[model samples]
Target: MDSSFKGILYPTRLPSFGRFPAPPQVHHLVSWFWIPEWDIAPGRSSRQHLIAFAACNLVVQHDGVELSGPTTRASHQDLSGKGWAVGALLRPAAVPSFTSRPADLRDGRLMIDAPDLLAHVVEVMGKETTARGAEAAAVFAAWLLERVPQVGQEALLANAMAESISNNPDLVRIADVAQQLSVSTRTLQRLAVKYVGLSPSALIRRRRLQEAANQVRTHPGLELAALATQFGYADQAHLANDFQRFLGFTPSSYQKSLTAPL
Candidate 1:
């Protein structure tokens, strides 16, 4: 289970959210499964903000399923009524099963025609049990396993590229990632476009920004310039520019907002 709120911007305002690791059988296909259940008062709304991971997600809700592509900026969802969503943070190896032109679907989503999958997950979620999250993730993993039984070598390489860029903060440049993965820079770019929708540089930037924001929120007294140095930004101004561009607020403002009265 992943309890850390890595990409979520406002953990304090979230509803019931759970993130479970993918089963070993489907580990190559799915990074993890996340579920967010929300119930708001009448005439009020709870807005959830995020700088989503630089990867696609297959989300299953009450109505149907959706394949959400990678994002380039901050985004939010307003929940006004009772609802829940079971989402799979798909790995690069599994993206082709859902969409081939992932680059075209950047910052967008496509409706998936998977009624049986939706029904099965919904049934498991409706069950009265304490392990709804784990059970629902298991069923989701089972469905994915049935759909994508075998992963190709190139697809596995793409997954390796994504994992390298995401998990290694030292990989601040496309060349660094390419060298780490022992692939040419051109090959890395092609893999990212075909599987991740975002460029390798974009993925690195998103990871840095997310880490910087998390630090700002958790370590309110930390100097922005020091954070920038730690994250490989040129300076404090660069970090502030990233925050303003992606999150629409400077680091100081964000930190102040965190401690502000509601």
Candidate 2:
């Protein structure tokens, strides 16, 4: 498991998962490229759980490409055979090229018709002796640059908004993100809806929740009440409520699961 597993809930269950930084050419369009290659034996399965980042993903599998919209809650995928997938964690600036109404595709996915892009990635990944991480990511980034050659000013602003909310823990409120980005709250809300498929407030909560969960997993001895205060939750109960609502478990339960024997 990697130290930067912020969104992943159970690192022990993952297969050969790798996340590569996107090249500078596609920085405005992609956050990073993630690849997962798996081979499971007969009658076995690996289920990966995630409190996914509140953004879209462009995924390429052997079959086809698909555009995944923002998720409103926890999600999981069960892998049960030999397979590989190349995925780009798309930035807000890249969303419009794929969908007009991001909000409509919340917690959903749209199959895309990017045969050329899919073929290139698949071909790069199929080379047995080549190091697939950087090469595959480069191919994916190149395709993105070709597809979305230019980013508009408003789209860049949306990217900034998403980055601000995601990176700043002190930004617990929508107004904080708006002020930090020099935009009005209404404008922030509109940008979030158009680009992120969730409200600004939802983005804030997701980051907080992801951070809190990461802390709980990393520091099992930390007190819940103190953790809540540190993450801007009103109290321990509020933090527990968030964990229950989104992750389907209380903080203590999640902590205990981490130590449970296999």
lDDT of each: 0.91, 0.91
Stretches of candidate 2 exceeding 4 Å from the true structure: 1-3
lDDT tens digits, residues 1-262, model 1?
1328988888989978999999999999999999999889999999888989999999999999999999989999999888899999999999999999999888899999999899999999898787998999999999999999999999999999988877888899999998988999999999999988988889899989888888887787998889989999889998999999988888888889888875
Error of 1 at 213 (Å): 0.8
For candidate 2, what is the TM-score?
A: 0.97
The runs of at least 3 residues in candidate 1 whose Cα sits more than 4 Å from the true structure, single-residue gaps closed, are: 1-3
Task: Give a tens-digit lDDT track for model 2, residues 76-131.
Answer: 99999899999999999999999999999999999999999888888988898548
In Å, residue 80's CA in model 1 sits off its true spot by 1.4
TM-score of each: 0.97, 0.97
**Which residue window of length 10 is worst by lDDT in model 2?**
1-10
lDDT of 1 at 207: 88
Clashing pairs in 2: none
* Cα distance off (Å), candidate 2, residue 221: 1.4
